[model samples]
Target chain A: MSHPEQAPEGRRRPASPTRALAEPPTTRTPETTRWRICREVIIHRIDDEAVAYDPGAHEVLYLDADAFEVFKQVDGTRDDAAIFLELAQQHGETTDEVASRFAPVLAAMRRHGWIGRTHGADEVS
Target chain B: MSTASTIGGRDVGPALDGYNPARRASCPAAPGPESPTYYRIGAVTVCLHSADARFREPFHHLYQRHYIGGPTLSAVHIRVDRVIRARPLGRGFRICVDGEERFLLRKPQAVLPHVEWAINAAVAATLPRYHQLHAGVVARDGFALVLPAQPQCGKSTLTARLISRGWSYLSDEFALIDPDTLRLDPYPKALCIKEGSFEIVDAFCPTAGALPSYEKSWKGRVRLIDPQALRPHRTPWGVPVGMIAFPRYVARPAPALHPLSRARALFQLLDVCFTFGRYRAATLDVLGGVVERAACFQLESGEIDATCDVLEAAWRAHVPASGRPDPADLTRPEEPVRPGVEAA
Candidate 1:
């Protein structure tokens, strides 16, 4: 997986307002490894939004367009760096800019047990 | 077997009209040992056996045309009677089903409200076949419009207005939908007009004066308007839902109709359905089909006429000409008559 520093030239621009607002704090450990969507999470996309129903938790979540795209990419194989790279390519932004925008959202999803870290063994919190 | 009469080309059994409480108590309807008054509300047959004379008048008035008499099975059996000797200070009466007390009436005047409450509870308890939603339902041109809202949202007022203006009244309190087909069944009970909405309903329905209002009840000053009086013809029992609307009565200049996305509509429906948890997957699937086939909207209005206009326009636009079913096609066989004995 490519790191944020290896983002291609010409795609880098000033961070958008959402990226600035969603910027992760430096004290938190960077989530470099790949994250997989929880197997129990069932997602149904309607129009621009997606509704995720977790049978285990009996919880229903509403994911907006950007977050829904991020969730849809969590297939257990891709690392966070790779997911951000693809999102950057799709939205015409640098990998660093996409990472900044999705960093907080991804961390929150990990905390909520919506996604898990895959490092030889699955770890979901 | 009791004598039957054909009303509007449909066979109906003798109503509890001429039988005073004393006469009813002396000779309950036969074929059974005890006399239980049988009344049909749409598809549900309720057998009410109450010895209290106080429950007779209001029960007759509220459920006038719904009485049926034959030898069919009853879906629910409800009994209401005085708890003890009618002392001035004693608790008034108790409503029970299978000897289990559901509610107690504190005064003679509170009998009607308690009976209505008890009947609703009985239906909720006894009948889990159809999925019930906390919504108001009305239909026009072979398609039903479902108004799902929380209490005090002016749902009954709007429903009464629309029904008075020629839209067929299905129900005001609960919208019963078939879990398999998503077709809405009509539960045309008396429209419970609250105190705040009396003026609006009276203006729209001039014949509403004949209906009496019960004061100091559970829902404040409440009046029950018999939908039959407004539209004397036999209305349809079921209709394919064509539209799902969430109405909000706001202090606005004009009525506004905002389109709702399918996801939002589904979420709103799940929130309002009474049996969502019991039939989760089925309810979700049925709701998806309903949302797909129907146009969903959020209506905000203070003016009743304007709101009706908006709904009618939606009906014309969305419900196709070929898709409209005749009212007669939607009517079911006259509610089955059951042998019930009238108790004192």
Candidate 2:
């Protein structure tokens, strides 16, 4: 069995904010870990926002435009490192700022079991 | 109670929770002069049987407006009988619905509220189709405004003030939303006002003082107020939803009303919503459509008079001079919540 908490080689927690933008922190997510939205979730779109219902868990949550955007990015194609950089560029924020902002939302979705992660991005489909 | 008129079009059978459909011989009603009173409140019909006529007079006084002449097939049966099991001075009453015992009470004052509560349960059991909310609904000009109220939220007080000021009374307890029509039907049950507000209510409803009081457990002493006294001939009926306001009573000079996104509003509403007969998908659809068409708001309500003013203003802003049927009446929900948006 593999340990999920074990960080990959050389990806350690950065000491400062400036160093964070360059080497984001290893605590938030593993660099090789890619997330995929659980396929069983139901979504009802209302304008830019969406009310996502998890049938398996029987729970509902409101995903505002920003959260929805972050959700859309979790296509199992990109790791958290890539997503943070992309959202950072789009929102005009540093990678560290975007990562911190996106962390809680991802936590909530994972808590709802709406998304799952796979390491090394191997056979993600 | 008409078979054709049952809520959600579901037939009345064993669906009534805890209702024993055994022949009336099994659990006989208390032996006495039982007065069977049939009432139709919104889409549900209830037939209540009380042993003593004088004992149930207060109930008649409060629910006089919603009474119907004849009985129907789908009616839920409630039997409140004074049963003296052991003690004579503190006699007990066995309250039953369709031959199943619901509540056993000894206090004379507790009878009325418990009977009202048993009727409340029967109504929900009878109408398994609509999604019911613990809300106070009032209408103006034909459009309904829903007050999604939680306990101690002053919903009863606010609703009474609005109705007394000429707003049509829909209900003070249940907001019945038909899943098919996506419209709210009135369930204008009497306003169960806590003792704290008796003086204020008596100011507008003079008869409130004369009505007998019941010591409702946890709620303290309560008096049931007939909504008709608050607004005459404000007959209950179906109305299109215009806005849903979640009010929080706080000390303030004027109430503050803020817009809410449909997603957020619908989620909050579902938190307090009960699906009686039908289940989830329909609730999501019915409530979703309501949120999409209606303006959702969160209010910090102050004194009743000022709060009414703020609520009226909010409703008027969404409904134009054209009287809410115009295509423009379909007001869009506020923008999607930005990151870290604070709730008001």
Query: Which numbered prediction scores highest in TM-score against the true structure?
Result: 2
lDDT of 1: 0.66
Please list all clashing residue pairs in model 1, or write none if there are none: A34-A79, B35-B341, B35-B342, B36-B341, B51-B344, B72-B338
Write the residue-wise lDDT of candidate 1 on B183-232 in tens digits. 88877777778888888888878866545556445578677777876666
Compared with the true structure, what per-residue lDDT tens digits does model 1 show for residues A2-100?
435221211112223344345443345345667887658656556655556555444445454666778878877788788998999999999999988
Interface RMSD measured for model 1: 25.0
- The weakest ten consecutive residues by lDDT in model 2 chain B span B12-21
- In candidate 1 the C-alpha lDDT for residue A118 amounts to 75
Q: What level of docking quality does candidate 2 show?
A: incorrect
Q: Candidate 1: which docking quality band?
A: incorrect
What tens-digit string does per-residue lDDT give for candidate 2 at B233-305? 6555767788889999887777888877777787677665655123655566778888887888888998778
> Which run of 10 residues does model 1 chain A get worst, by summed lDDT?
A6-15
User: Could you tell me every candidate's TM-score relative to the true structure?
Assistant: 0.74, 0.79
DockQ score for candidate 2: 0.14
